[model samples]
Target: MDRMFRVLGFFTLAIGLMAFAGDLTEMALLFFLQTAFFVILGYMKFTERIYILLFWAYMFVTFTGFSYWTIFQMGLPL
Candidate 1:
């Protein structure tokens, strides 16, 4: 069971890297930040605090939402 979470964590990291690679400079920094977050979560799997990772996920989502909201208010396409 321990190994399962670790594998899942690595999977998340892989997905992050894949997405990070496709992003251009305009969004590259954000992708790198997100990839780093996933890397942290991957390590956390060994420490048994997966829930903390979920909390970060929530925060990221909230931040992204606020970003888009602000952009929309400014008459941006996305």
Candidate 2:
């Protein structure tokens, strides 16, 4: 459902914000939350094309962020 996915997205965003002040555990949690949010959007019913596009966009952003975080954690340059 659209409403369900929206709620989940909000929840994940909140968790991601909270994770900003924590350690690896929080970061990992945030990563999973973001992934789930996008995946849910990708599969939700109604307006499938738009939701799919948005899902890919979110995936790109999340993947880039995750890659940057991993690189930073490894003390590597961007």
For residues 1-78, could you state the per-residue lDDT of candidate 2 as single tens digits? 456567666777666666765665767576567757655764567675676566578679879987997887777664
RMSD to the true structure for each prediction, in A, is: 5.0, 6.6
Alpha-carbon runs more than 4 Å astray in model 2: 13-46, 72-78
Candidate 2 clashing pairs, residues 3+ apart or interchain: none
**Clash count, predicted structure 2:** 0
After superposition, the stretches of candidate 1 with alpha carbons farther than 4 Å from their true spots are: 1-23, 46-49, 52-56, 59-67, 70-78
Question: Which structure among the candidates has the greatest lDDT?
Answer: 2
TM agreement with the true structure for every prediction: 0.42, 0.45
